[model samples]
Target: MAIIKLSAIERRRLSAFATCLVLSVFAWLFTALSSQQKYKVKLLAVFKNSPQKRAFHSLQPDSIYATVQGTGWKMLFSRMNGDDNKISIDLSALENKNYVVLSTQLKQINAKRDIERQVVSIDPDTLYFDLSNRLIKRVPVRLVTALNYQQQFAQSDAINIKPSYVTISGPADVLAKITYWQTDSLILNNLNESFNARVNLHPPAEGNLTVLPKSVTVKIPVDEFTEKTMQIPVKLIHNRNFYDVKIFPQKVKVTFTTSLKDYPDINEDDFEAVADLDQWLQGYRVLTVRLTHMPSYSKIVKIEPMNVDFIVKK
Candidate 1:
């Protein structure tokens, strides 16, 4: 511990280490400076030609802004590489003007160095965004039958659909070709009473038609109908009691058409006829009976002779 001192060679080595450390720091600083630089660029957006009206009137100044971060070299390289960092503004947000300024700011490598001023100019600040609204109609759906379904079963029921209408929006050229929107074919067989289902609306293939509400609901009503043949016994009614009377027709044939739900409750008793023999006997050789009573829900399609003939026996 008495005395320990660095030799000449050790001093030289220590000085060299210090110098290298300083030079490394300087090199790092230069590299950083080269990576960070600020510059201005112009942005443009073009709209397709159309007769439709536009939403935005014009863009204002101070709308253009710069994205700050990289060195001038990197920014220039990015520009040459076709790297676009511009923000797109919606045309519908603008009024009658054609262009508007989006934003403007100084871009820099670091937040501290970002204070450098950069001038940015955007030509045609306002962009014309053409837009239009078109009305699309709904087409009636066709009824189809399943392959396995009984062919004899006819469509004797009514059909109902929910949300009968739908709206569509898109490019004017595309929208104009649309005539109507139709749903897929729906098959109903042996259906009774009420039915609820979901269906999709199909757009025409040729147009640029786009439906606002893509889907819709469909409803159909099913009912039962029946045809019944009934035999109504014929009876002769005479005005004078105990007068000898005779009926040529022993029974009357009656056919009724009604709903299946109520057909079972219907019978021949539902119909009747009264004959006035006194008035009919004077000039007529036979008196016929006409229908006087029938079920409200039932319809009489035909009756044999349309009446019952009766003769007076003296």
Candidate 2:
């Protein structure tokens, strides 16, 4: 090999190439450093397959902690393959404890090989929770009505519901305060026949209790209905010498029906039978009696012998 001498210009070119190579390496290092960052994510520790015997009233934080780690473009993308960022805690370890805390290991990191060795301290080493024992209870339902059909139609009858009780189940503390439950209002307006409905029960406002059976079946009996018309004995307000006028239908007919339970208490007086003959002349004959006024519980199915014949005398 012959010794070769390089010119100043050639030497300068060699130096420039070396400097470019060094800068390229530094640029790559700077880019990677900027792209990487330490992120803290909350890890939820859950006890799987925990025994039912464990109550909800007991729980602690020290039993769980989050894993600390560094995330970047490369690792984050690789995470989808098989790298799990989360870990599950053993619930059996929390038995009989109201609270617990746990310390987690610092996960993977990417940095200057030296910087990567730095360990990060997690803010919290443990988590807290409440354990409750599941429970079930039975509650009775009460039905209330604002309208009184019994008094309106002079019918002594009552509406009733079936399966007046239901079962409710939830957390023990939540079920303890619950008392009697109620269903939505059952409307009886214009109800000519019996009806049945499935209603839901609402739990008391302030409690953790949950109703197991949310809904109930109700059978409402409207009771048999009946009506009657009775002739009213009308006495003229004026003396006998008053203008000649006649009241027809000296007797009025009455009709009605009711539930067997109330049939005995029902009578002609329960209905008002009246005939209007004030406009009739002394010789006027043939009057009609009308029935009005009925108890709420009682429905006027129909006025038996709807028409009655009477003579009006003036």
Please write out the lDDT profile of model 1 over residues 274-314, one tens digit for every residue. 55576565777556667788776466678776654666556
Off by more than 4 A, model 2:
1-132, 144-158, 170-176, 203-207, 223-314
Best by TM-score: 2
Each prediction's TM-score against the native? 0.31, 0.33
Candidate 1 regions exceeding 4 Å error are: 1-156, 169-180, 188-194, 223-225, 229-257, 262-314
| Highest-lDDT candidate | 1
How far out, in Å, is residue 88 in model 2? Answer: 20
lDDT: worst 10-residue window of model 1: 105-114
